[model samples]
Target: MTRTSQVVVIGGGQSGLAAGYHLRRLGLDFVILDAQTTAGGAWQHTWDSLHLFSPAAYSSLPGRLMPPQAGQEYPDAQHVVEYLADYEKRYELPIERPVRVLGVHRDGGLLRVETDSGPWRARAVISATGTWWRPFLPAVPGRGDFGGRQLHTVDYRSPKCFTGRRVIVVGGGNSGAQIAADLAHDPEVTWVTQRPPRYLDDEVDGRALFDAATARRRALDAGRTDTGGVASLGDIVAVPSVREARDRGLLKASPMFTRLVPGGVEWADGTRAVADAVIWCTGFRPALSHLAPLQLRGRRGRIATAGTRAADEPRLHLLGYGDWTGPASATLIGAGRPARDAAREIADVLA
Candidate 1:
């Protein structure tokens, strides 16, 4: 069976929820197709120890402010999950769950969202599926030969699993730092990075990163010289746990290994170390496979966009992917503006 709506949202995460809020406010009919069985989106899948980089007040959706978690400054993954569940309830967003979207194909006057459940036709389709489902592991030589366990950020649940084992944590981003720190006390962990990890000052957090991103966006809009945003601020934010781990000398990073051997990994200088497991916190690519039918992606593997609207496919809007769709759009606090913009544009086109 085929359903029809004025707009169809491809995700029910922070970004998708934000779009739903704006679309509802605009009095537009829409449905949010979520692949997950329940709420919380990607937060439900994150490692148990994961915490937001900013305080609750600094991290919130468009309509509701996330209430402070008692006895905690930065909220954990569960807190985020609860908040999202509550947000969806509060707004009464029309979200369909466990509906895996197959692809989006252009119809004569609308877009057909093909999903496992059925097809939905919409005048405008907002693709808000974020990247957590698509973990990106860099290609390393002899990776297949490694007899030990290998997992990506998406597969990691807790450091307890690696307890008492020799583990190698790869990547230099926030996940890498956090996972390595989480494992350091209990396990023999070697944090490997392509380059030395650059950490933001203890005082800096997600709030500052959002501010910098906003400033950069403004400067670019005014045709002024670029203000290096988050990149200028450094890669890792010294969260409390990470800071404590660093001070205790547990977060020390080593140069990236040259290749994976059956016993372990070897560096360019032929230094070898044995590890029982290798955890890759290498990050993710945008989960855009469902959008493949549109053929809007460019040579860079990204869909060109004018604001949130796809450059080639005007009926399609991309949301919550990252800076390309909007400044800081991937974060809870940053998804609002882009979502609002996309909703208003869709409303205008439909009207």
Candidate 2:
């Protein structure tokens, strides 16, 4: 079956929902194609202990503010899932689920979205597929030869299964810190990083980071000297759990290992530790495989964009991948602006 609309959104997550909200406000006909059978997007798959670094108020979608969770400073994964599910319903966004998009290709006057269910033809297509589905694990020598289990952030659910085991947690970003803290009490964890982990100030959180990004963006727009944004600050946020672990001296990080051995990993300096398991919180690449047919990606493996519109293909827009799409566009609070801009641009183009 072939369905047609003014716009077709390739993701039903936060970014897609935001795009839908704005598109509906502009009275544009669109449908959000979501791969997942249910709502909540990636939040439903995050570790059970995962919590936002910001308060619920700071983490919200357009047209609605997330209701505060009772007795929780920062909302947990389930809370976020509920919020996303509710947000989807509250706005009555048009969505089709369990529809895995195979690829997107240009079709003379429109874009054709090929999905497992059917094909959708739209004047414009918004690729809002976020990064959660693509967990990145660095290549290490002897990784396959290791005798223990290995998992990435996407595969991790909790530390309960690793209890009483010697586990090695690798990476230096927020996930690495949070997962290390989560396993600190139950497992003998050796947190290894490329360098010492840099922590944002105790007082800093997502709101501060978003504001910094916004200010920096405004500065650049005004043709002023570039002021540092979130990148100028450190990486890890001092969430309660990370802070508690830090206070207990359990967050100490070791330099990254050179390679994995049969029993564990070894450093270039000849330091080695035996471990039963390794948890890699290495991070993720953008989930853009469905956009492959367009061949818009540059040599750097990213699509060049003028705002949300693809620089090479104006009929296609990318969203929610990272800072390149918009300032803080990946976050719940930050997705709105870029979504609004994309909707308006698509509307203008279709007008």
Candidate 3:
């Protein structure tokens, strides 16, 4: 039997939950299909030590504020997982778990979502599947031949696994800095980046980035140009551990190696460096392979979007991927307005 819904929300992560919250408010008949066996979604897969860049108050979804633990300014991954589980319960969002969606195809005027749990028909679909599943690894020559461990940030868990081993952490993003700093306490770690990593002022954090992004959005909406002086939230923030690592002279990053060697990596001048493990902190591409059947992808594998709605398919909306869909859509607090707007639009169309 084909299950039917007014809207089918794919992926039950932060963005999906936020969208569900608004969808409920509008009394829309929707179903959220999650690939995970449990409730927490991608937050369940993050490394144990990973902490939110912002405090709990700033890192919340729509409608509900995330209550931070006492004396803990930043919530860790576990806390986030618990909060997501609680959020779903609080809203009573209709979600089906362990129902991995195989693909979404146009069947007549409706969209047919083929999943492990059978076919689901919906008037509209929201692709909220975030980028965690699609970890990016640069093509460093001879990487395949490197005998030692090579892992992306997704596979990393604790620094204890690399204790006493010489490890190379690649990438200039916040994840690279945090992981490098975390590993430096015990392991012999080297940080590498294509360009020098930019560190924001100690006072700058996710809140500052959100404020800047809001201003830029306002300016763009008013047909004015935004100055480039505002720093990207992706830039490394001086968290306590990162600052302490800098004090110990362990936060310095080396230039990216030209290629990987059997036992290590080499720079352009053929200077070789030995390492036991290589951690690719490189970012991720959007997890949009399932959407490939729709042929909506454009340059750099990004779907052209008009206010969170797919440019090619108005019935399909994308949420929580990044800034392209909406301002700060990838963040906890940032996703609220976009999700709310997307839900309202979907409700109107499906009505």
Candidate 4:
């Protein structure tokens, strides 16, 4: 007989782990399937020097509070990872680590999840993995012809390697800003973007955005719906990054890439330049390729999840994903309510 779990939480990051903890707290039988060797999804992959802008207060998981801090500054990458690990241990969460999930589909009244390890059967599935897999690389003509090594911001780990190269970081998002700042340490670095970035307040406590998303979700839950969502910019809000970079003479605004020649880049301003390396910090898409055969709501890989999607398919909900044109669904702290809501739904399903 094939054993089944009440809920299968995918990915072991903040969302996934949070769901696991909540499920256990509600006395539900759930399993957390993580692809990485351990928790701390993006934090572990981020560069060594990267630090969160969100204060430690807002970054806490379900059971444990983040270590005391002097102020509202963000936590370092390692500290975030350590906190997550402690959460799993404190809650006694059952997480199957390094289990690479291929996809999830409905099969005979059960959510059949295919993974590298084996088949998993569950009543509901929570896709806690965020939108970080598909690095959004804008199509540039002859992009492959360039001689220099091309890598996305995801692959970047440190600036020591690019100590002498004229590195160019594309896109105006936080990743681009951080990468450009890292490259700024090298005098040979040049920053470029398609447009000037939108700068919000430097001290963007994600708690407010989280509350806004919760309110919008509650509004949708009620009969009166506005059909909108909210977003969070991690610990690195847009305003601080843009302002900090500008203060250091490191902000550039214009159409960045027009074409890629054999050994040079063609900018939209009709300027031709060659760089030793180009890091595309453009952004990422909802990484649902592994989740084949699921009826997603968008042409892109994203699942069209809203207030209803969460309620109806609580067992199989999407979190930390951009709402596209919607208000602000793509955020970290905003995921708390969804995580708890999904946990409650799964508990009911098991009952």
Q: Write the per-residue lDDT of candidate 1 for residues 38-132, one digit (tens) a residue.
A: 99999999988999999999999998999999989999999999999999999999999999999999999999999999999999999999999
- What is the number of backbone collisions in each predicted candidate, taken in the order shown? 0, 0, 0, 7
TM-score of each: 0.99, 0.98, 0.97, 0.86
Q: Is candidate 2 or 3 superior in TM-score? A: 2
- Candidate 3 least-lDDT 10 residues: 226-235
Candidate number achieving the greatest TM-score relative to the actual structure: 1
Highest lDDT scorer: 1
Every candidate's lDDT = 0.93, 0.92, 0.88, 0.70
- Candidate 1 CA-lDDT value: 0.93
Model 3 lDDT at residue 330: 81
Report the C-alpha lDDT of model 2 over 1-351, residue by residue, as the tens digit. Answer: 898998999999999999999999999999999999999899899888999989999999988999999999999989988998998898899999999999998899989999999999999999999999888888899899899999998888888888788999999989999999999886479999998899999999999999988888888878997778887898899999999999998889999999999999999988889999999999899999999999998865789999899999999999999888998999998999999999999999889
Sorted on TM-score, best first, the list reads 1, 2, 3, 4
Ranking by lDDT: 1, 2, 3, 4
RMSD, each candidate, Å? 0.8, 1.1, 1.4, 3.5
**Residue 277 in candidate 4, Cα distance off native in Å:** 0.7
Worst 10 residues of 4 by lDDT: 227-236
For model 3 the local lDDT of residue 127 reads 96
